[model samples]
Target: MKILVIVPAFNEEEGLVKVAEQFHGINDVDVLIINDCSKDATSEVGRKLGFNVIDLPCNLGIGGAVQTGYKYAYDNGYDIAIQVDGDGQHNPAYIKDLIKPIKEGRADLVIGSRYLKKEGFQSTFLRRVGINYFSNLIYLLQKKRITDPTSGFRACNRRVIELFSARYPNDYPEPESIVYLLRNNYKTEEVPVVMNERFGGESSINSFKSIYYMIKVTLAIVIDNMRKIGLT
Candidate 1:
């Protein structure tokens, strides 16, 4: 299978090399770095490492950056597309575990979750609270449980690649996108994977913005669910 690893980076020059090193000597997998108009040398760093790089004209946030990678995968005829954040929190070593279910035709989307084993960097207490809130919200809407709805470390088959490429959220999208797929009857699964603190750069979401994130994402998911039922 032709697998493409999509790393969406924004001002992550310091951690790009370390992230790339993890993929070294891995045969038959291509990595694409989506530089989301970073102010730093993210694009240059990606090219210097010999990875395919796409530099957007403007910052599109995480959701848009990831959607750009999905579009590239769709156009390039990649069979599987994996999303590993450029922040370096996600471990590329567990990539095999992520794509396994897809290869076996058991799942359309597989999310690498940190809560499954209660291992790795579990994030801040406030962030964990937000994650739990979304988990319950999604379950209430879909009757399905997604332990880590905010996890960006995930893999998808061509079907999901097509879905996301055509229509994706603009901001704070992970939770809403999962619900969108579930409403459409796509199979989603989670596999336990250890994560780490950011290798470099600061997170875009801070304590102050967490509140906005919660409100925006909650509304987006609810509206998406309503749309799926023709209530919007």
Candidate 2:
């Protein structure tokens, strides 16, 4: 199966270089960097490294940047598309493991979970609290246990690529997209993988943004669940 690694970058030139290094000479895998109109040298760095780069005319946040990758994957006929953050938190070493269930047809979406093994960089206490909150919320709504619902490290097959290309949430998409897939009866699974601290660049989410993220994602999940229930 043809695989594409979609890295949604925003001013990640420093970290992106390290992330790109892991993909070097990996056979049967292609990398695409979606430069989200970063003020930094992300685009130039991607071009310099010879990876496929798509520069959005304006900043569209992570959701829009990732959707752009899905569209590219669908149009280019990729069998699997994996989302690895440009911040260098996600490890490329686990890319094969991530795509395994998808390639075997066991799942349509596979999330690389940091909590399953409970190893590596386990995020901050407050952040883990938020992640667990979403996990429970999703289970309450869908009865499925997604250990790390907010994990951006995930892989999806062609079907999901097409679906996301056509319609994806605009913000905090990882958890919400899982709910959408489950509500519609798509198979989703999680695997044990280790995540690392960012190689460079500050996180977009601060204390203030963390509070907003929690509220916004919670509302998004509830509303999506209600909409799905209404449709059913």
Candidate 3:
């Protein structure tokens, strides 16, 4: 199958080159970097590494950047698309694991879960709490347990690509996307994977921003659920 690895980047110049290099020699996988109008040399680094780089004219946040990559994958006839963070947090070795279920036609979407199987790194306490809360909420909504709703390291087949390309959440869409897949009756699963800490560059969301993000994302999920149930 043709696997398109979409790396959504925003000011990820420090790690973009290395990240692209790691995927350069991988078989059956083509890397595409969506440079979200970064102020740094993200696009330049991607080009230097000989990657298929799509430079957006403006910053579109994480959700828009990712959707742009999905649109490209869908238009180009890619059978599978994997979302790999450009921040060096995601390990490319687990790419096969993420695609296994989809390739077997057992799942439409696969998430790389950090909490699966008591191994390697764990998220911050506060972040873990938030993850559990959202996971439970999605379980209640979909009647299926989801352990990792915020994992960006995921793989999807053409069906998911078409869905997100048509309509996707603008900000912090990971949680909401889970709902989207569940609502449409698409099979979703999480595979165990390790995530490294950011290798460089400051995080976009600090403590205050994280708190605000949590509140905003929670409300968005609630509203989306209501809409899905024909209550809103």
Candidate 3 lDDT over residue span 43-79, tens digit each: 8888887888999998899999999999999999999
Q: Any runs in candidate 1 off by more than 4 Å, and if so which?
A: none
lDDT of 2 by residue, 1-232 (tens): 8899999999999888888787777878899999999999999998897889999999998899999999999999999999999988998889889998998999999999999999999999888988999999999999999999989999999999999999998777898999999999999999999999888877767788888988998888888889876853
Better structure of 1 and 2 per lDDT = 1
> Model 1: C-alpha RMSD to truth?
0.9
TM-score for all models, in order of appearance: 0.97, 0.97, 0.94
Instruction: Output the worst ten-in-a-row residue range by lDDT, candidate 3.
Output: 198-207
Best by lDDT: 1
Residue clash pairs of candidate 1: none
Q: Among these predicted structures, which one has the highest TM-score? A: 1
Rank ordering of all candidates by TM-score, starting from the highest: 1, 2, 3
Which residue pairs collide, candidate 3? Answer: none
The global C-alpha lDDT for each of the candidates, from Candidate 1 onward, is: 0.93, 0.91, 0.86
Candidate 2, which ten residues in sequence have the lowest lDDT sum?
Answer: 223-232
